[model samples]
Target chain A: EKSSNIENYFRESRLEEFLKLTKVTNSYGIFTAHHLNDHIETFLMKITRGSGLQGMEGIKEFIELNGLKIYRPLIQIPKHILLKFCYKNNILPNYDYTNNSNAYSRNRIRNNIIPEFEKINPNFLESINRITKIISQINNKEKIRLFNEFEKLEPNYEENNISFSRIIFNDLPEFDKKLILKNNSEKLSSGTFMENKHLDYIIEKSYSKSNNFSLDLPGPIKLIATKKRITIEKLFEIDFQ
Target chain B: EKSSNIENYFRESRLEEFLKLTKVTNSYGIFTAHHLNDHIETFLMKITRGSGLQGMEGIKEFIELNGLKIYRPLIQIPKHILLKFCYKNNILPNYDYTNNSNAYSRNRIRNNIIPEFEKINPNFLESINRITKIISQINNKEKIRLFNEFEKLEPNYEENNISFSRIIFNDLPEFDKKLILKNNSEKLSSGTFMENKHLDYIIEKSYSKSNNFSLDLPGPIKLIATKKRITIEKLFEIDFQ
Candidate 1:
């Protein structure tokens, strides 16, 4: 009965939407405590969903949402380790009981999938640790480099505040094309962005066509491409809703 | 049998000899791939044994042999994630089936403990992920800050490398004090540093006692504290055997 109420709330309003409605953005950032197993489950989910590096980039310890920063300090730890830590510190947190249920996808992973996997290979955790470390280092450097390049090309609009032009971004490296689109789209007042595929559609169309084309981005940012230039504009006015 | 034979060969010669014979040095770093599960298992084993962080710290990925720059990239990852990753990537690594048997403390965790854990709390993985992330970030920043301060005080051998005078390090903040001992001790030509407590003992002696007192270190880093000055020298030429 209690679980039904929880399920009802989920059906009525998506978790993401609910968070957005209540989210009070401040200097510190939106924070979450996601541990290692959660990360693994998420990684698997994204992979199953066929998400690329951006989706699989793990949970962001710090993310910028409509100029509000989000942070997750616990992304690097695993579940069992955290519990041990709590025990060592003599801090016992409330434990949840539904994890063993096969109904939830993540719970299924915890019970059936991973245990079966551990049975097949004892060093399973070790291998994931290696891959994630490598990915983090490489991705972090790449993000920094791309962000730096982006800052150079994207004009800062002090007067309009959230507005930026995409004309300059067109001149950057092809690899960065996706980065610019994602950033610019996220920058919009809607607080959403054109996906990788959507951005790709725009980019692909830009080369073949000459007319001005507008993309109704998921976020506040809009994209208009013409033969002469590609422009990214913020449709929203203020930082907050 | 083949795997056991290979493991035994490595255990007897490669592992044992490496552990016993390798001189701890500053010139190179020793690294290990300790995963998140490994750390938790360690904490579990220690708790079951009625121990503390001495064993628990090894639960997380850390620079264990400091002079050797021993790194554990895989320490932050859980076993299930690694297995899923391996499955997705078709890595097909060898499996160690001993984890299924609860003969050892960690194996008990692998078999009985964690499963019961998921039963009570489905979000156990998520909670762990959050805690580990916090620890990793804190540890990472702490290392950087300690290294930066230490780097400032120590004589620059290269942009990254530096030499710390024993006397100067004695005056550092407690935060930087242990780090200096850890870092400088690790960097010596012979690998190893005295225990943290012993390093503290040496530091106390440097300030209180005459300037020219020699303390026995665990590794090749020599500590000669005298009233006139303190000296930390690489004593790899001395016999470790």
Candidate 2:
């Protein structure tokens, strides 16, 4: 039934199965062999999709979901190196059928786009790696700084609700304000982050002279802004009426 | 002879001829019709070439080149809209023969990569436009902040030379320090900016306990670091020894 959205189904179903397996086997984490080439391809895909810095973060070495840990131990290794090691060990690699076909966006990028990039700069992958490393480092530092500022704001959290002073939020730099709102939204909704446009709308409304207004987000999260405070809360089924 | 390196020659010759025309005509600026599609193409090309935020800034509406002002009034307009306007007026537009050929990187992006991107997101152009706009705005704000911080360091500039306190420079964030060094190098060299690798090398050395070291850059720009100071100076022909 979900075949029409095969990509989403594949991702969600894989995770669902993996979580069940982890519980059955009592494993703390699972490691995947995503390499440098995969990382670069993901970065290129994000750029084409008009991603901001957060989205362009490519792949991380570690991440946790619902108390389950995932690790990418070979992320820094190049695919060629892995292939060489496999060959030397007389190990045949399993290849995904779709990876060789251009029907997928990632395959197209790997086949068409990356070769042209290589023609422009033979060491383009290394250059991309270096640049993204620097960007990620800067992003990490900024994330720490922003999180610290958010903590200092003394936001109040109730059951299914998070609220802070609109006056203080309005005083923040626009970029910082947007990030704080995004982080809080993601927190209250577990993992769903608000889109930039939605955040912009809420921010614009927050700055308006109106004393009271409310907006609904995709997670049925409601944001209410008043004369002095802004509240983000998860709306219940009955609240929709 | 120049035809062997046609792209560079074309760019340099065009700029040189334009400057002469500006002087002869006594005009403050010249306007070129570079639209949104062109900007997006340039952005994609830069990404393929592994450009940083500055390179990915696409094109500015106005830029000054050796006292000649250049303007792109149609920068925000999409090419299709301009074409429609031209057609409605029964105007014949001049097309560049090379633009239709995939020999050029820009043309390849226009013909091949972008169509694939459209399939991924039909409104991909607008999405790219929006993201780049936000990135450029953030970049401009950060530039101002970095420049101000650079100014506060009170770097001393002599003819063909600029120097600042190493202690103060070392205290800056890695990203800011890299930008400051890049900006200063460009200033001293009258527009030759250092590559990220070179900047990284300089920055790594600056943090080292070694008190005195000197490095030579492409423009014969010399960077000398002492226990307390770092100097950037343009080296003349006789200084090569």
Candidate 3:
């Protein structure tokens, strides 16, 4: 129901799509034709933008959207092959001129970046997919590990907020601390933009004696810390989906 | 001193230049004219080729090479800016034809890919530098943290290798396990290409009930597991240098 040619606005629209699709569709997924080039571009984008393991994971084949699913079967298929298939079958497809044009970040990545990457290693895209597949398997196990670890942390929750003591958090491993911060902030934004810098800052402050401070994070959420606890909540009353 | 016309081989040669320069230089430093673009290319290469946090940390202004140092004072300056200065000052520089050719991976990335990334995010290069700066700071702390953590691991040793028991290794966090493996393997290769995949393999096998297996890893290192311990050693005696 929404589209944005601009890169900055694209994420905003995508975040809200889960909610929109919930109203219109049955439990079945809304299928997309996003192919290999798109996935490769995403990998490149995450790298260029300085993302972590999650960012490197690229796009998922299936994403749970409320009760519905967003499925992309052609994600692993190369765009050239898809074009070849269309051409061989004598099917005329509408060309998106914007893709050919260098308007969007993703378009620029696909058109300009990936070809150069291909020249480096022809199998580069597939290699990234290989890592993605392995990491996804590891993450499946890690997801369960995180929830179980979170139980040890003993978080307290109100209707709109969750808080954890800094005492135990400061002593945890760096990744576990990151997982706890990410988990605490996940529900604050559907856009999923809470970044490492924000989490790092809060984690840093938690160790210091500074009693009270609130940091405005990327989800546009607020992470407020008092003498003993840290809490994250949405600053605005907007539902994602 | 070995120099690579193509950036791909350049980094490979750069890795081992430490030992090579140890033989030649009189303990001062070797300087190069690598500007900001080259640094950016290395960052891009590391990302496309699937690197971890250290890869994103990019080039250091100074690198310790035995008694000598590899220095790049002009690393912060962009190529075009250097060219502009050269033009304004009437400085004659030798023209390199290979840069115009699409034969090298780094050249292709620099000449083709970067300009396209510029179209997407004008601040993209600077943004990466900013991350590099921040990560470098954290990595400094992390380096100390790793050593401190390693001390607690209390590794055992024999004639050929340092060994950690699976019972204790399996109990450690995933990243701690990775740090342990990496710390142990750092002596194996000065090239620094032992990736997460290789480490993950050894870590995975360390926990499994099955023992007495040897895993051949990238960097040509072997992770040999006995009933009680896991050992990582250079699979071959071939010096990459």
Candidate 4:
């Protein structure tokens, strides 16, 4: 019941949907055991796709998505350690079939990329965790705190579209700029949605006198900068909201 | 002529030696072709080893190091493009024997980790380049400018030591605080010196009324904070300097 149809086929939104669906019957949000492997793969994927600093920061320990709080408690513990724990407790771990196959880019990264990274530096995973922790520390400090304060502005990410108030987002600092533009804008093909420059261009354009201008991103993502709203949508997605 | 004994063994200070040795009869600074692949590999290695934002910015187009300008003009051009350019221009590129074998951690990253990244995103090189360019743009703007101003404090990275002004660094904005603490302070065994937590801890300690307090980093790197200075040095480096 936790694995919904949307999550089974795709990665992004289904987790929140599943959590919300579960919340109807259960109490609080869904707590998960998304281990270090998951976090590391996400990190690998982020850099590969040319993600900005915010995107490269793997996963939050607690994420409020779609009004549902999804908590990942075992984010720091590695898969091997968990397996060892299971062994010590005399409990057999379930081998998820999905994890074994290369059905998704994530699986490929987990099965292939991380191993190669391991070969380069035996403590590579630990190093990534240290960096992740450091980035988390930074986020916890002044910049992220200030950025979070500006969350009063309601930014919406619908099915195939992303929209936020143009005037509100324009004059903010770069950290806030990157935060809002991070996941809210993305292209369907290749990796990385819009880079810092792309996001900066869009933000800069939103303030200009031209009321009707659209910027084309790689892989059919179009950012339409109307007078009041800056919207990002997939050009190929026929049912875009 | 290219791979000097200094460069063959060392990664940091030796580059200056190689340049100086080469500049015996040369007119000005030594320019080399450090292609995009090299840059990308370095970047991957940097973040994997808990590098800060400054460290993750792989190679500089023009770096003035140790009274010498080491210029890498083809840094923006990808390896494949350079290879194609070589083929079209009828120029035979010299094969660096070091790059061929996985004798070094960097070689392993270049030969192993990057290929896996490529598999995840075919245009991963372009993505890295895009991110690097974006970072360059950000650096061009503000954070980097402020950080560069702080560069007047000559932070030395000796065999077992790294030292800069404790008083000046303590009162900096977070960006400058982050920059100085990055490469200038690192564990002697690993890639990255200090994480954000370590920096924050040091910065926090610097302001305290205590005259002499010492904080130990990961393993051996000790940040000794005195009345007038904060010094970082490996615990085991025999020579005190």
Backbone atom clashes (below 3 Å) for every candidate: 49, 0, 0, 1
Q: DockQ for all models, in order? A: 0.03, 0.42, 0.27, 0.47
Tens-place lDDT per residue, model 2, A91-111, is 998875533322478877788
In model 1, which runs have C-alpha deviations exceeding 4 angstroms?
A: A1-31, A67-69, A83-104, A151-173, A187-196, A219-221, A226-229, A233-241, B1-241
Poorest 10 consecutive residues by lDDT, candidate 3 chain A:
A1-10
Clash list (residue pairs), candidate 2? none
Q: How would the candidate models be sorted by DockQ, starting from the highest?
A: 4, 2, 3, 1
lDDT per residue as tens, model 4, B1-241: 1243223234443554667676776757788889888888878877666665665678888876545678999998889888998999999999766444335778677777677778878999888877676556555654556557566555555777777677777677766776656545533433234556777877777877888888876544577877876677766422222
Instruction: Give me the candidate number with maximum TM-score.
Output: 2
Q: Which segments of candidate 3 are over 4 A away from where they belong?
A: A1-31, A50-53, A65-68, A85-103, A131-153, A166-183, A192-220, A224-228, A235-241, B1-36, B49-103, B130-241
The alpha-carbon lDDT assigned to residue A12 of candidate 4 equals: 37
Please give the range of 10 consecutive residues that has the lowest summed lDDT in model 2 chain A.
A1-10
Which one wins on DockQ? 4
Alpha-carbon interface RMSD for all candidates, in angstroms: 13.8, 2.1, 3.3, 2.0
The digit string of per-residue lDDT tens for model 4 on A17-125 reads: 6765787778678887788888888877776877756655697788765456789999988999999999999999876564433347887787777787787677778
Count of clashing pairs, candidate 3: 0
lDDT (tens digit, per residue) of candidate 1 on A1-241:
3343334333324334535654644234455667767766665444333344454455655665544455768877777888898999999777655333223666665676556546544544544444445346546766797778766754554422333344565566665777666755544433353555786787777655457787765544566665555666765432321
The lDDT values for all models are 0.54, 0.75, 0.68, 0.67
Higher-scoring candidate on TM-score, 3 or 4: 4
